[model samples]
Target: MSTATDDGTREDAPPTPTKKQRRAAGIAEEASGGIKLILVKLIGLGIVDALALYAAFVLVMHEQWLVTVLVVAVAALVNWIYFSRRKLPAKYLTPGVIFLVVFQVFVLIYTGYIAFTNYGTGHNGTKEQAVSSLMASSLQRVEDSPTYGVTVVERANELGLLVTDPDGEAFVGTNEQPLEPATGVEYDGDLAVSAEGWKSLQFADVLARTDEVTALAVPYSEDPNDGAIRTPDGQSGYLYVSTLEYDETAGTMTDLETGVVYSDTGVGAFTAEDGEQLLPGWQITVGFDNFVRAVTDVRLAGPLVYVTLWTFAFALLSVATTFFLGLFLAIVFNDMRMRGRKIYRVLMILPYAIPSFLAALVWAGMMNESFGFINQVLFGGASIPWLTDPWLAKVSILIVNLWLGFPYMFLVCMGALQSIPEDIQEAATVDGAKPWAIFRLIKLPLLLVTVAPLLIASFAFNFNNFNTIYMLTDGGPRDSNAPIPVGFTDILITMVYKVAFTGQTRDYGLASAYSIIIFLIVAVISIIAFRRTKSLEELN
Candidate 1:
């Protein structure tokens, strides 16, 4: 290689490696890397293969052929990719991309799909399954039928009741075939105790599975209208008939005793003329009815508006209070003259260091209305409802949230403050600018560029901070005025939770609509806030 002197003369000085020598060096380095890569890939892929095999077996058993096929295919693809000598970029990205698709993309898509369907507590399964469930649940004992001696048995991997009529004729039947005579039998007594094509559940096994035994219903015949045999007590089976009859051709359930025909309402349930609904309704597509109900249903709409307002208030106040308090502390501690600054900073962050939910629980205990530390010890037994009174409970939540949230803001503000050049603040001081004016005009705007996005995130987090609200008050100080499952302190998220779980109104579709609303609110607000944040960046 040669280099030009000041006069631009080039001179050849030293011999460089030939192309073949360079290629050899590259090959040697690549060979070393290849061995290490092979070992890592083999170990990782082996574990993945083992897990895939287990998952495929489970999926196959569940009759989920598509998922089973996909799992096996993914395992094969992974092996092929890692074993190949190409696609370096794909090798690095494969794991993260796969995980993102499965965990995030799939979940969001499923939730969105559920939001559009009536997939709640009652409306959970197919129409056929729901009809079967209704039929099974509505069974009544046949009083005039002959009493049969019975024992619980297994046939074709299904539980059945082995029975014999008053004459001691042996029969083995399941819920699907309530009374089919046993082909092969060895009578132990008048009970006709032993039967072929059946494996008797031992007396000990019956004792162990009391719930299963009680739930067991063996059909008398393939025709459900023929009635079934149910063994309430393990020793004997009773002939039972369903009061409601399902007509497959008509797609209707008829009450046998009452003669009331319940036709499919296409509203996730079977309904009669009087609007009586059958229990355990089927899942159905409802279009935008869930969203429509959220906005138009009398029970939900009124409480939802109040909850949305409170949600906004709670999130805004949380962000504002925490941010200002954190900024104040950050400014105070940022001073070089402050004593034990590091210790103070560490003590300040202790709240953030502990889990937020745990902190919320501790606060809940401290702020309890009756016989609490705040009421008894601090207030001298005043019975001040820190968590019960509507306005006070709201205040209490804000105070608790501030305590839990400010530490995070403090840490972020402290970091952002330190990043600001000291010379800029010093220049303002030399220019005779007052502390407040300088902060408002210069330092604050600069700090925002770093912290504004976090503030927006904090607001979004507080908007749906379910744990804090739940563990603290469980969204209480009940709004008895409204019929819906809501409270004065209830935010939209907490109210959705109540609608889905805590009360009888386990309407998951409605809850999901509420969630989609929340998502839109957060997404819009974030977009606007981030857009405004761009100005802060430009200010810097």
Candidate 2:
């Protein structure tokens, strides 16, 4: 390497620039050249962008795909344009902001708009689907249709159906047998007529044979107008339908033999003129029915309301108790000179280390009413009603939740306490401030500045700690007197579980509605907590 001379320039006795300096100066020149090259780069980018947009239009709209593709493609293009723009970082942020505004804000508001209307199970039917499902039709039941009792006689892989009538007439039919009618009858080794040449018929022949026949003494029952006839035993019925007439245009079905018209009313179900509704395919739109049911449905409202209150109470108590105990423990353990402090700290954190659900289950067994240690301690040989009673269950839940939660607070406090300057406490002590005065005036205010946010977060977590509530009590004792099968220990989420899924089948729409409500509540609380923390930060 050449050293610089006193003139402040490197002197290797060279009159020309070195390759390294030329490259260094070239990089500097490149940096100072500004966005002149960037413009050309942007122009190329624009050409590529134009090609992509054209391709997207051709592939999305002009292709066989639905409008959804076009929407997504345009959205992607918008994001690309915003990200590629050589403006400020805030300018790039505009696309994300617009996306969230358009989709999350507007689309979500639109969904809420739809939710207010009749949007539940039956009401999910589109206008076209509803109209099609609600159409009307005519049914006809033809009488005296030729009918026969079919008995499948199978040996090995080959199968044959023996068709018999009430008059002891019999004919052997196979897969090739179309709707061919037999004229001769045979019974008990007596042939009423000699069989002419055997006729080989196709399967379609039998299906197309619509001629009415007399009812026979079969084991099942069927409609006489159609090939459907009932047997004397009443265990089964045989009914043959022609065209299986369903009026897709009218949204109704017609029995071609009975002349019965089943019409769809779009409310309740498909009702015949005689007021008999079909088994299914009926869609109804009852406005606010779900909300009304949720309020009035004894099964849901009673448990839901009580559980909701308990949920709030649990969250509040859990926060208050955990905070105080944790803070106290944190203060005691914060002393640097405390003996075996590391061991004690590790032991204190054991509760958090243990899986909470497993711990809860173990505790539940220990608190069991039949043969638990609590009963032995309290009643010499009997158990306490810890799990059975409502109040006791709530209290037990709070205790268990405290054990699971306080360790976290302690850990946070320990870290925050270290950051509190010793000088502040020393100054307070020297100024005649008492122990409480030092803590209250100096340590606590500083601790709050750090831990207030954590406190709010803990509150939020405890608010939705479904596992704790469920694992502890399972909302028990079968409150049969209550509207639903809710227990005293139940919370809102558990109540929702019971109301939505414990029935004969799951009710998804009602569950979705309840979830939306809970989401709104959590969102509002989070926003409030965030703002409050911000205010505290500002104060600090």
Candidate 3:
């Protein structure tokens, strides 16, 4: 449509969209959005499926049949849920459930399993593997062993020896399989150069893996009494026999030279009459023994008792000191008359803004006995031995923790105090209550209702505060007299870590037992604390 203005200029009007055209446009837009959503879903599911398939393949190769089945089942369930329009809730929940099962549940169950077994350095394999290891460790070369021409070969990533005897007969063997006659073995001089399906290692390859080539023990025959063929140089092999003979029927290992018989007394190792035990013992279940050892072992009991006590004291004192300091500062700054309150509040929380571990490390450096800022500057070069002395180390840890931890409590208390209504305090004051009475009766109870749970969590966190103790003192002023490596400042968690990782012999089962005990202690304490906090809710 066109209209003529007074100035004789023509004006054109825009056309309006019809109802059918609008509806068609809407439908097309919806279709495009649906297609996009489908593409996204497919891409996400494809990635998940790829990862799941890879994990399943690895599990299958390891012969973990049950775990492989579980993984496959989970992947299939995820696909079914995501592809179905009806399972919207399931699609949302599946990822979280899968992660929970994989990380938390699996680790908990495995730790519990290890806690009841002798699963440490020397007891980490099956009985058969232990027997093989024991035999291999005791192997000695025969007096008149015949040397055979040898060549290193690999098949399916397993190394084997291809040897040609003096009679011109070729044979091949690996650690798992006994020597068997080979057909179609290519020979150069008297050495077996290559086989039909095996890849022969060149001189460069053999030199690069000299240790593996030399340690590769090929069994001479299937008989237990027969010795194995071992190579010192890649070109020559010799027969070596084990000094100890294992009798499977009688479940005993006998020393041929000493005539000492070691019997398996169901203790995961072969023990002789003289109380000597053969190592590389198989893992076995010993229900409650680890737990009993923690409490009953003469060497560990004294340190355990003190460490447990110190752990409790440290947690309790950390919570008390941090809370009081934070609460006091929060109260001071929360006053209406306080000038520049915002700046002060921000300064108070600066410690919390930094990472706790980094703060602990900085404090650790500053608290050093001779070279630290605190000793050299603050104390005027006083050698106080803050970390080296036992009592002072504990105090130093408490001081640093308080400094690092108070800022968090300050922020929490500030938030909680702001949440408290001013009307309640005014009402209390009008009722003839003094300022202290008003706070004790009204503000404190209400604040506690919000912060008690946080305090309990703080206690739990400090109970296992490995970073502070580990970074500050490393639980040292080491107890030289203790049989195990323990210190006066060692808490339960740090003690567990030291026992499991720091020593020559890592006792994982005992550490796991300690971990279970810590869990139970924290659980019981949390339960009681949470229940007690319920009484504060009545003030609301």
lDDT of each: 0.85, 0.62, 0.89
Report the error of model 1 at residue 57, Å: 4.7
Question: Per-residue alpha-carbon lDDT of model 3 for 216-312, expressed as tens digits?
Answer: 8787887555878899889888999999898998999998989999999999999999889999899999999999998899999889889999999
What is the C-alpha lDDT profile of model 2 across 1-540, one tens digit per residue?
Answer: 477888899967556678999997787555435577567646755765676566667666445465446555655655465445343454447557767977788766654454344444445545434333232112123354444455333223333344555454655433322223344533334322222234322335433332211222211112211222322221122433343355667767665557788776655455788888644343344556655665577766667777778878888899888888888888899887789888988988899999988988888887888887778666787867888887888888988989998898888888888998899888888888999988887778788888887777776777678788778788775687885557888877777667555755445456546656766777798788778777656535
TM-score of each: 0.86, 0.58, 0.88
Q: How big is the positional error of residue 199 in model 3, measured in Å on the Cα after superposition?
A: 4.8
lDDT, candidate 1, 1-540, per-residue tens: 787878889977778889999997787557436767679878999999999999999898778999899899999988887777665557778999899989998888777888899988888888867876788888988778777788878766777777878877777876545477787776767876667777888889888877888788777766666667778777887788889988877878899889999998688788999999987999998989998998899877788888889999999999999999999999999999999999999999999888988998999899988877988898998888899899999999999999998999999999999998989989999999999999999999999999999999999999999988988888989988888768989998899888888776588888888889889999999999999889777786
- Please give the distance, in angstroms, between residue 335's alpha carbon in candidate 1 and its true position after superposition: 0.6
What is residue 88's positional error in candidate 1, in angstroms? 4.8
Best by TM-score: 3
Query: Which 10-residue window in model 1 sums to the lowest lDDT?
Result: 28-37
Q: In candidate 1, how many Å is residue 290 off?
A: 0.4
The whole-model C-alpha lDDT of candidate 2 against the native structure comes to: 0.62
lDDT leader: 3
Q: What is the lDDT of residue 171 in candidate 3?
A: 95
Candidate 1 residue pairs in clash (backbone atoms < 3 Å): 171-182, 175-219, 177-219, 178-219, 178-220, 178-221, 179-220
